[model samples]
Target: MSATAKKGAAKKDGANQPFIYRHYDQEKLRDALRKMYLIRQFEEGAEESYMRGLIHGTMHLSIGQEASAVGICLGLTDEDQITSTHRGHGHCIAKGADVSRMFAEFFGKITGYCRGRGGSMHIADVSTGNLGANGIVGGGLPIAVGAALTAKKMKTGNVVVCFFGDGANNEGAFHEALNMAAIWKLPVIFVCENNGYGMSTSVARATAVPNIADRASAYAMPGVIVDGNVVSDVAEAMHEATERARNGEGPTLIECKTYRYRGHSKSDRNRYRTKEEIEEWMTERDPIEAFESQLMEFGVIDQKGIEDIRESVRKEIEAGIEFAKESPMPEVANLEKYVYTEQA
Candidate 1:
């Protein structure tokens, strides 16, 4: 039977289906697939450029954690704000950032975000409600809380999503921020992308709690866990958390159990984890491949559609690189322009 026919049959048989299959239509699901591809390809292109010395400075790549980023932001609107981590290209893309501008920023061109002053880790688009990516561990936590408080005071009804790594859970800021948000009933969702390791240290060694989500109970929030490799699962958790926040029920802490193919950053030698483990995650649990299979199985997309998306992303990446190469750099005379406030 065809995929749709199978879906119909399953429905008639009362078989439980993924939340996305019931909630999203074909177009949205396909678009989610496309965004996941875009994030992957964009990071690949960035890594290539960084290796070639076309881009300066080091970067943290969230290569294998695409689904967690895309899924968490899937239910968020343009008005919804997010605070990202150093490894945040995926989060930026999932929240609707332009690849060309991101590439330009990496290239240190004037047309880029922050006018090239802020590179990969600092890219921000207020227009899309991406407050910005933070370099410090757990730095964005308090900032997200502040934004949520503003949204509450303004009655904007917009929720703020805070994306942090497993390492940040131990930071004092994490505890303080969560406690404050919960006490105020702020519209914020604390999303912990637990990829098993905090740099070289295993999460098991660092955290006392077995799962990062368990930490949420200390703050009096609903703690939830989901398979981060599954986009639909992430989306379902985010959707519920978002609704609760909008209803003035306070924040939710969601832990996404995922993996990253690359090291923590360009400087990481990856001595802590074994090659076999990385290979297993990459080959068996690749988020994009798994999501694509889900799409095909649910009749959302076929091989040709997937190919088309890949090709389009390829062209866009190429164009972005070219644009960065040809774009102008910042003027030497304007060094202090954006740094200090001007007198009226």
Candidate 2:
């Protein structure tokens, strides 16, 4: 597909309800908000099915971090690139991956993305400009760094955004990649979605610094900490950082403070955190609700418009499930077809 196939229309208002946008336009705000809502509904649908045994492999849902993905994606162009972590459905969608094919993969259908070979963690989709989602904790950072290096070397005026969790900050690869990108002044954005935990271990136990962005100082770059729960803040920071990269600047580390409403995976028993913590995050900091309220207040989009958008997303998800269910599975004879880089 062409780079502009799924290209987003430029937005200028950056405003939404309850509060107006200081930097972003209303259209961009609406687009990001809409994408975030689609992500929420899509993940919730996956959760409902995963628990019912329709999904075979482990599924990681980023229910509370919609703002991080959408906000960041809003700042990027189709020519720019992104690399995502294990829990990456939101990234894929925000970057314009096919929702139907994603659900088909989740359902293990032959028509699925990856042709039913790769499951949740390995969904790569180039047409939409989403490189792929990494199963390893820090695998994507280096790949993004390499992509950035190439962009800088080729003078494409494009940037690469690397999305990972706070847990990945501890990985040696993460630090190494940042160091390289810093020195090279690569057009990259290292976005750390710090939801207070690395798998089950809280961020407090994982790091000494109060904020992950503070580490950017060590690399001689700007480190920004934004309220990940608020879409406005995330969009503002990402837009500026993106422009910074395009203007021949180094990378930026954006630490988005958010939360995950679900457990680490479908198998998790939900015992790592207190009930109060979970409930507080969901009730007070839910990104979708927060942004929806904002949009409503700003009168950018009415409640009915938002509801209609959500309903459309929900129906699309259901159609994907149906398409996956009716589709065929991978043939036994072709089991090794996609396992290796080369074909027979």
Candidate 3:
């Protein structure tokens, strides 16, 4: 069948997908696809490095949550800020963090985002409005609130997006931060990338509420539930939340129901979840696959276009890995440089 006929048939059969975006331009959609593919490839590289014993510290992989990361960040501008969690490579990359430096950070080279001190969990680049990814669960919440407060006080017209796991939502910091933001009308977006587990503990076993967004009602703000696997759905939700924040309404709590294809961390084995469940998510409901299908149905790109994007992303990641490998390690004499700030 011809490409036009195929597209027409898909639409007739309702294959165009329900989350059709009206605001996002064609270039933006293509860029979103590229960014998501880049995050996937970068995580794959990190896994390869981890298996080879090249990386020292442990790393958390968000292999299945790229849609949530890219979707939300697509709505944010360069001036907007974000806070990230341990599994924050996607978040950092979405916020325009340099991949080469990120790989260097993983390699513990001096050229990394944290100058080789923070490793994977603690990567931070304030220049791109990514404050940092915190090692502690729920740690980024208060930091995000603080950034929002700063933006509010200075009238910078910038919004802060905080990316935390489902596990972090139960912490006291989560509640306190949301309450404060609501009361002060802080321009912040609290995004819950609920990947179904908190380091082996299922959300059903830990969280009391059925949905994490339900907690947002306590703060007297809007609570949005997004299909974490759908990039367009996430982007639209973030756009609405950002608009509310920019209008000085208050903070928003968004729960994205996503899943992690791999284990929680490097040491984790397939103990809690089943193999069938993993296969289902990875094969059938994979975010990248779903997004590609939708893009194709929308006539945004053909199969050749998809392949080209993937090839380009693969080369970019390979270059980043080479950059990290050739970078110099931190000098012992400069170990304490970033530890303590000198009095100005």
Candidate 4:
């Protein structure tokens, strides 16, 4: 059924139904679940490749925070842009990136995004509206505001989603960007994926506000908090924010209270968090599993359908790795090709 039709049917059935069921059709919901799985499997593949030395440099994994990534982008179109963080593989996938090209980028092959120069921390797909992932903390905030300003000036009616971690809340750019976005009435959504820690330091140690969303009040915008583990909840919050932005009501700050199963980066020793805490989140609040159960309960998908998605994702990841392995590498002589702009 069409989304509008489904929404009408849902309203006729019951108002208490989750926003996702009321807004999105079954096909879209299933696709959302599939994308969540893809994000999880893609990260796992990248992690394995990194361990085997196929990928160079370090990568931050968003293993347990799949729901936040997928849910936020659920209502977005290709025209709606997003700036991602270093742990941005999930964001790229959520924004409709090709896994093969992503794997190629990780392998530093010439066929990769940014011609293999960007790697994991800098993957950008303009066609999919992903501006690029930044390695620096709080780096994407101002960039997102810039994008939103362009949209507002051009009357494009497109919104920009800026994905940052809990640590970025303490950055000067975060406050500046939020204030600027608010004053300009820009179509930007500041999504704080608070995974509890900024490197070894927890949010409690780094941030003063009780929740990152609370800071939005200072900017004179609405602040929302959602269960990042629950895809429906995240989607609901994102949908509301998107509507508000598209209506020219200015920006919104959404804090997704989630956790990362892995360390901050590949080199992290994970001494700050305990094993039981990580295990509890992984076992009890695994985003993909929670989403899967939701899909099943809502009759959106069944066991066999879920298995099919898993199998499809597995094959895709295998093919993506092979594609990267078979792809060509950039020559040493052309190292400056994308580095410097030639004077016209």
Report every candidate's CA lDDT: 0.91, 0.83, 0.89, 0.92
lDDT of candidate 3 over 191-252, digit per residue (tens) = 99999999989999999998899999989998898878888778878888999999999999
Model 1, span 1-344: residue lDDT tens: 13224334544543567778888888888889889999999999999999999999989999999999999998888999999999899999999989899999999999887788999999888788899999999999999999999999999999999999999999999999999999999999999999999899999999999999999999999999888888888899999999999999999999999999999889998999999999999998899998898788777899999999999999999999999999999998998888788989
| Candidate 4: tens digits of C-alpha lDDT, residues 229-256 | 7787888889989999999999999999
Superior candidate under TM-score, 2 versus 4? 4
TM-score of 4: 0.95
Candidate 1: the clashing residue pairs are none
Give the TM-scores of the predictions, in the order they appear: 0.95, 0.91, 0.94, 0.95
- Error (Å) of candidate 4 at residue 340 is 3.4
Best-first order by lDDT: 4, 1, 3, 2
- Candidate 3: misplaced stretches above 4 Å? 1-20
| lDDT value, residue 58 of candidate 3 | 93
Locate the minimum summed-lDDT window of 10 residues in model 1.
Answer: 1-10
Model 1 residue 148 lDDT? 99
